[model samples]
Target: MLLNPLLSLSRSPSVLQRPSSLLRPLSSSNLPPIQGGSSSPSLYCRSLVQRLDHDAFLTSYFWPAGRKKDAFFALRAFNIELASIQETVSNPAIGRMRLQFWRDAVRDLSNGLPPPLHPIPLLLSQTTTPSTRDLTAYYLNQIIDAREANLLDPPPPTLTSLLTTLSTTSTPLHLLSLSLLTPTPPAYITSSVQHLSLSIGLTNLLRALPFHLSRRRAVGLPLDLCAKERVVMEKVFRIASGKEGGEGGLSQVKGLREVVWEVAVRANDELMTARRELELEGGTGFPVGKEFMPVFLSAIPARSYLQRLEQLDGDAFDPSLQRRHWRVPLDVWLAWRRGRF
Candidate 1:
């Protein structure tokens, strides 16, 4: 992972030039603009989720019609809203203001009313009805908090730190989805979802390597690992940003492939761990996986992604990896049939 160095937004000339409207408080008079054109809030949220995050959209697409599927769309849309703030702004302070608006919106949702115009927060507010079970304010806030951390520009400085950050985002979404299936979650089910969430989240981040490299602020590889592997961040960024110098740019990044392989290996380890945890706990007590397939369905795509990355020799910036239409649904359906993901 090669990321841009941190820009000193506080003292930077650009921050002063950024519009004051970008930092205004969120209220009826000052609410930030939201992407609102669908026929209904649910339609808006579902389309936004599908359009922005196809991988996650597929997870909910297979789910049978139920309140749980609705919850998945609301949650996924909320994630996109927060994740896109940075992309939508020119300055870090502006991005933070957008995130703060979400935080305030979450606060408003807790008060039994979200902004009337926005779809994500309003849909999220609906998910908190008395019957929604363990989908609590705490879990939603955890996801928001994690996104808030990344709002600063550049990602967590190391792989270990990065996992810590992702655990908040992915783990909460997975656990909350499982919780929607039942009010009182089993211990093993909880543990397995947590592990699987990290696995899926890490894989999701790894797959976005190219996109991140092209961004102004690129996430750097873990310093110690880079030092040990003799990986060069500059070369990694150049190849990743498609400025590959035309001389096998991926190969140019000394030991970057090894770092990516280690990440893949760890993801594989977590996949196995999740399966083991589910079997050990759910197998002995109840048929958790069979009953709650959609909650765990994300793991299938995550696994399929790992398999594809392996084929590319663990090169995160492989040209083929960037190609759209990777038969993701078929892979997920196959994994679904195996009762594994």
Candidate 2:
């Protein structure tokens, strides 16, 4: 799978070095405490992910302890903040300003300083070493750039366009996560990560389609597929909002189910491609390495969502689809125990 090129920044090594003389204790003004009065940024990130990104939070357990896990949560927390902007803000200008703040915050991180009182940046600044700092900032900035473009809320014209757009939005975080594990990941590993990230991204779009439709946001579904299926967004919106009898009216669209199936199939295909890359010559399809298991394990929930979609016969608006899968934790634990996604 092809991945988007990451944006690179250049700065002097000395510029990244912190001045020892200026170091001072954090206070309420410089470091606002999280709810419940805890000042720990890692804890804040952990709480944020646990609340808004439960699947990622669960998969985080497989990452080895210490700085790697801290970096993992920080990246996820940053993503959640960006992803939530379009939904939370009343206007695009506000969303753009928030994304710009993150862009500047990323610059501060590269300069070896966390933006004041921001838990995610605080944790990121703490976790990054000189070796990892530049790449981390690059990855964060790439995500910010992609999300800033997405704030315009353009529906992709084709499935190819959708994947192209999502490749930048979703793929970099996986790459950054892998970078945290090893500066030089094997070629196969990087390829597999790209496939998995796209798979997860596609699956997430499917799951969120109804919610997006209800809000009258740009349909996350490709216009080509929607047109091929004769899917009317107005009807989809009516069904999602219960104006036309809710999910029970979904079948009235005729082509919507097929469109959803086609997208879900593409998502599954990406996951399968990743699996094929990891298969041993004459063994079970489990991957060979334990060190990268945490990253690979992310595919579990994505796969599970795709499977659930299949069971629902490609119905994207099923209420049950919005609920967390009760079996995800057990599935993740088993996958981790077996050393594969």
Candidate 3:
């Protein structure tokens, strides 16, 4: 979900600019204690590290143990922080500025500067292997590319065009990162990441559709194209509902709620297909495909959330305030992680 002003206020620019706000006084003295000489870590940096550590512990069990696990955790943390900054900034311009800060930080890392006091950079520096520095730089560039893509409205129709737009953004870099984490690069890594990112973008687009349709808004996407996409999506939803299977006595309620499930199933299918293609392409020696398994499993939680919504709202299928319906993807992510799927 996009950050509103209220959410962004929690991490206001003023707070970010003030180093004092970021650090706690060690002794009740007016003078702040310095660590590593002119490189005292910020509270935000510490907190971010802690959060990353926690998330890593929870998710990294799936990863092979040792340095590989550590590297995977670090990369995952960096990606989370990068994505979070965009979602947390209240103003788009400020978000862009934060992203640029990241770009500079990445460049600085290449120069052997102690990681920036900022958590993301610090974590990235810690995880970066000498061999992977170039890959790191490339990945950082991808984040910048994604931010740039976000600034523009949705591009014109055609899957080719959309894929092109996505290629320039975070998707390909994410695929590359997945490739790096594995013992071997899988051919399907690119397709899987592409499909996953697109699935996420499409779901996000769906959530925003009602508002766009009602307001006649055309932010980065043409209304006609959006309409067409929605129609396809609706078909996708029906398939999810199992109505297309010709199973009689399937409750209409199931059909109504199938939109959420359909998205998940389609995303899973894309991921599986990508994995198969990668294996067929002689990329089977690497763990690249396995890296994306968790991401694909994320859909289970999304479907669960939809079920909860159906029970609670009962009228969740109605065409009203779709924006209000967005929830924490993490909730679904956690649930899926716990085998709740």
Candidate 4:
């Protein structure tokens, strides 16, 4: 999943200044050394998550501190690393080699063997104890397998294909996060988490479009939607490359807004379904446990980003979309206070 650059801690000093012990200074000296060093894996995890996935780092503050929180960071760090493989490696075989390492790592972690000298796996080994079984090899391997499958695979041909990619890549994250908080979350919670995962996954794909285009990777947007909307991929690349710009610049690209609108609408539908699931489970007065709210809080950023995109009339290329919404932290805090996501 692509991270929204808007919620980055580097861009928002006000978010960084929030008074919480969980918010550590994002300086290297304060974080632990990398893998194989004698340092707390939690610190390494926290540092890695903050640097690579700031939104995850920001949402992670909602999780209770200690082992549960640390486990959440470890899981996010693992995901961030895997998500980053496409950008890091030039060759598909090299990416597979890396994925193979993680596959072996997960297998070892589940078998109670000494994990390889990696901070994320080591931290996971310590927190996901056999007694608790909080994190499972099944979920970890699902994520790796999906990432491996995506290595040389072409862009999704349809929306169904896109959701299938998310079902494995994103769904497992929510399940694993919920498991860290409670061994068995209510069925409603599980269902809602699944919906939220897809919602966020779609939103992230939109947010990352600019970044992907810069690298000539037109992967997240489905081929069917592009065909239906007459969205010329070459035109999109020219616009992104600044080769097609003047007055009425982005508008020159045909059917792009329609494609964006379709994607955003799907994201909103998933988000609303998640909310409706919660309401149906307990009516309007459902009791939101503190333990459960952290998982729900992730919805705040996704909802906020989607709302802002809608305000711009689904203009994905709008420069305003790149900046952090000043109210996000306040919105998150207010949602937390009201016992809602």
Candidate 5:
């Protein structure tokens, strides 16, 4: 899905109007039956998420088997569906149309019905009971609105605007995942969850930057941060996308590495804050239970990614940072056992 095109310093700061919050009546009866996908419900969602995005697969790999995996796969499948739009579509207008379709689909799901035209929402609906769907309906639609908000990239954002962008686009998914893991989520940890989710969202935004610029020729870096380091968008796009092929692409930019470090430091602060909040002692948040572990495991990838960014010395276009590192499985395993991520 189009990430929060980050709150651009040059762009207008218009917030998304939530259709879910508006309380408009929905005529879900007109929703069509799911069509076109041959895979079974769970299998379809599972395969879709795995093929398109393996991070969630690794995160959910540690979850206790059965219903939890099914539910999370459905959730990540929907996320992948939204995330792929900007990368795959050549035209922004077509992307908008597809996003509108998903907006409608989420509304239908909120009404205890999912559009039959798409397998993702259909399978997601089936994975959970109607009552469970009802509870998650608001957050579900929020994600659609977040995707819709960023369909057209605006100006580079301020740090505040960037975080707000993520609070909607990313934070809700974490909350929903936690809900899926346990019906009775701890009330006090909402702040911690929001912190961790926002941090992960920012980290992913950084990870996806090269892709965003390469696929669409647009940079999503917060404008304020880019300014402090005088990052040049066009050069960054070429280098990060590997279109620039001298030995040292990172050296081409004047301050790209420093810009990346600024963002990384902010992300690191958020990550450490989340860890403290989730700490079992002298912390404001609750202890993470084994059942709740999978939802929080996202921190592992975020941290590993940050470390990689550091390794590259903040060169946003470094080739070594593009591929998955060898130490990821070990990082994930250690995080799982320690309940630290």
Candidate 6:
């Protein structure tokens, strides 16, 4: 499966687009008009199916037209919804409970029984087949594992430890899932997804660092290294955001932002390097020249957004940094419409 050349193309930036006003809270006018009939099993199932279709519509650009595209998107959307529950829930206990619910749902699906009435399970049922069922179970188990691991805020003793945790927590499931689904998943897919996931995850982590740092400070944890990483990360963010100056800003933060930037840069380079290596190996399903545009475009804006966060925060790390960096870039929208990198 790795021999397929088409899979070699980099994911385009266009794959990230959604309607600009979609993020706004639903209002009465925006809400669907109410109907008089009671919601039935068919109605519920149809609604869930529509959601799956909507998810495919939103992300189909990342995938070429094929059965794989349809099946993968359906499974991916379900995974995204399940994963979001854990991240969005404020209480760790509640998050764990939701994770367990998903775990059980996976088992039920695997047993040739339909999943429970939850939207995710309902959606999964529409796409379920014997071969895909195990894949779904594997993906859900990985999410559950990640959730369990995240319940505690353990400080890594070394950089290796941090990377090890990230690989185990964040990388494997997606890679394995795509690998299983695609007739042959190009090496670029794994490399790209890993790089993209790490970049986004780390960006989110950096945004939350201020809160973590404050908590650490209160308890008097030796945070010199953490502080330095934050400084480095901020520098990377600034560079990404098109801010003035370069590494010179590194000194201003006492190295906190420098540390963070170093982490992000290293992570990005690792992914890019892996991609290069994959491209060297007979080059997968599609030629890079044709496929790379979308991938590069999507990635640039995401990288820029992280950099923007650094600028918005200036020299200091702010707890609410994410909110400040939430706006989608114009390039991202353009890429989405173009549907190619």
- Model 1 ranges with Cα > 4 A deviation: 1-39, 131-135, 155-157, 239-246, 282-288, 324-326
| Number of clashes found in candidate 5 | 9
Query: Per-residue lDDT for 287-313 in model 1, tens only?
Result: 345557677777766777788889888
For residues 1-341, could you state the per-residue lDDT of candidate 6 as single tens digits? 53322222222212222111111111223222322212233344333323322222233344444444444444554545554564356677887787777778878988888668665465555556676677666766776686567554455655566656556544554454454345355666656656654554444355444433323311111145556444344343454344746554433545554566655565556445545644555655223332333333334334554566556544334323323222333444445555332
Clashes of each: 3, 0, 5, 0, 9, 35
Q: Please tell me which model should have the higher TM-score, number 2 or number 4.
A: 4
Question: Number of the top candidate by TM-score?
Answer: 4
Query: lDDT at 54 for candidate 6?
Result: 27
TM-scores of all models? 0.81, 0.85, 0.53, 0.87, 0.81, 0.59
The 10-residue segment of model 2 with minimum total lDDT is 4-13
Q: Tell me the lDDT of candidate 1.
A: 0.65
Q: Can you write out model 4's per-residue Cα lDDT over 227-304, one digit (the tens) per residue? A: 999988887888777887746556447888888889999999998888878777654434567778888888887898
Ranked by TM-score, the better of candidates 2 and 6 is 2
Instruction: Please list the C-alpha lDDT of all candidates, in the order they appear.
Output: 0.65, 0.74, 0.45, 0.76, 0.67, 0.47
lDDT of 2 at 27: 17
Off by over 4 Å in 3: 1-58, 65-67, 84-93, 152-160, 188-194, 204-222, 229-269, 282-341
User: Can you write out model 2's per-residue Cα lDDT over 9-82, one digit (the tens) per residue?
Assistant: 11101111110111111112322234421378888887666555656767777788999998898898888888
Per-residue error at 259 for model 5, in Å? 0.9
Off by over 4 Å in 5: 1-39, 114-117, 235-247, 280-287
Model 5: colliding residue pairs: 1-82, 1-83, 7-157, 8-155, 8-156, 8-157, 9-156, 33-116, 34-116
Q: Which of the two candidates, 1 or 6, achieves a greater lDDT against the reference?
A: 1
